[model samples]
Target: MFVQNIRNICVVGAGQMGHQIGMLCALGGYETVIVDVNEDALKKADTLLQSIMEKWVTKGKISEDAKDAAFSRLQFKTDLEDAATNADLVIEAVVEKLDVKRELFAKLDKITPSHAILVSNSSTIVNSLIADVTNRADKVCNMHFFYPPLVMDCVEVVMSDKTSDETAQTTMNVCKQIGRTGVLLRKEISGFIANRILGALQREAVHLYESGIADYKDIDVICRKALNHPIGPFELMDLSGIDVGYFVMQQRYAETGDPQDKPAACIEEKVKAGHLGRKTGKGFYDYAKEGVKN
Candidate 1:
């Protein structure tokens, strides 16, 4: 019902999560535009998306005709205003910074149609902090899509007190349209649901590794073999990017000023060394040897 009104979606950012999200929207039959300032990044996103679609075709997950139709509905643009002017929904996938999001929301509030909804794909930064910058606070909420949105099936739809019921319901409808499960949080929280649980597990894992209780690989093995988990915490960090976790920690610490919320030493070190997981070909484990790309 709510989904019927959202015909066009503007995804701001063409990086990892942004590109995949744009693809999902396009496949859902929404006219989707992904905007990025860097032309090189847009080109890379196009190439990667095409490769992923081809893999889906080969896997029989989607027909070649379906892939072609999805690509036809998707567009890449450098100008934000041009991309968002007619957008019925805008999902921001930019950097995990408060100021950046606030500024972007402010601009989007002015550029988009009055009825458009503005959502953030931030993992930790809550929408409450960003919504106040826009006049349509009732339409601003968090639609947190996990990393690699093409594969992940769950999206957290978080709402602040100011968010209207219509806004939250519409977002959930959008999720269903894209063939993903949507979990709605009536109250807003910094990390929402999944990441809060994941953060605790990761913190303990990092503590065990730093304490020399067990090697990171050994811990990961125990998690996979004994606990029946799909991947170890360290491996997940590498796949998601160590710098992303580092930034999430930084945001949490800034909000709470708690020492425990600061990034783990190993994460900070890895980020500083530019060893940000599969994207950099290194993180907790070396991916260069395996020729893996995230």
Candidate 2:
């Protein structure tokens, strides 16, 4: 149903996930606009995209003409209403907080085109909770993409009870056209698929370390070399930002109210110290002066 009319894409937030997701939409030949009140953050996204696209050219993945064409499709707007004026789809990658998302979506509802599909890139918080805040709940769903959306192929297409079949299908179609491997979740649940499995692994990894069964580094090695993972659990946490995991766990704990449901003490401490994974230069391991592997 959404094959022809979809064109303009609006992304809210220019943070780590937001900018990359907007870039991917541009690569899909859509007229993409990243909306953020923070001009500095948007400028950073511009700089980051230029660097990433240049690397693509250097690797012979995309021609100069293709790179320029994709770059031409990228745009930015500081005002949410201005950006979503005629947007066919709106993907929000803002901070992973329920009230914050509800407030944003409520505002987006007033400004965006009625037909525009609103989706969130929240890792733990489900769209079911946020969709209700908008009158266009039928058009709202979750389109959770992996970290570094530039390289990752997966996109989770989640629908709440209010999400119409057409809306869900349209979201999946959008994913396919953008070169994403879309996984549909028929049932509404916390954490969807990937994060649920990942959370299970991380929980055990933390337990093993806390219980003195093994150090964090040793656990990472076993997951990497033995399990054939590109990066270990600890490394993944660092790359995706330790603070991100902390918030996710906080949401989950609120739902379950279990002590074990809370974020690990170690993860909480790292965030308090401002060692937020690769971005801050340290988390589970130090990355102040070396590559992620080091």
Best by TM-score: 1
Score every model by TM-score.
0.98, 0.97
Per-model C-alpha RMSD = 0.9, 1.6
Against the unseen true structure, what C-alpha lDDT does each candidate score? Answer: 0.95, 0.90
Show model 1 residue runs off by greater than 4 Å: none
Which runs in model 2 stand beyond 4 Å of their true positions? 291-294
Per-residue lDDT of model 1, residues 1-294, tens digit only: 277999999999999999999999999999999999999999999999999999999999999999999999999999999999999999999988889999999999999999999999999999999999999999999999998899999999999999999999999999999999999999988899999999999999999999999999999999999999999999999999888899999999999998889998989999999999999999989987888685
Predicted candidate 1: what Cα RMSD to the true structure?
A: 0.9
lDDT of 1: 0.95
Collision pairs in model 1: none
Best by lDDT: 1
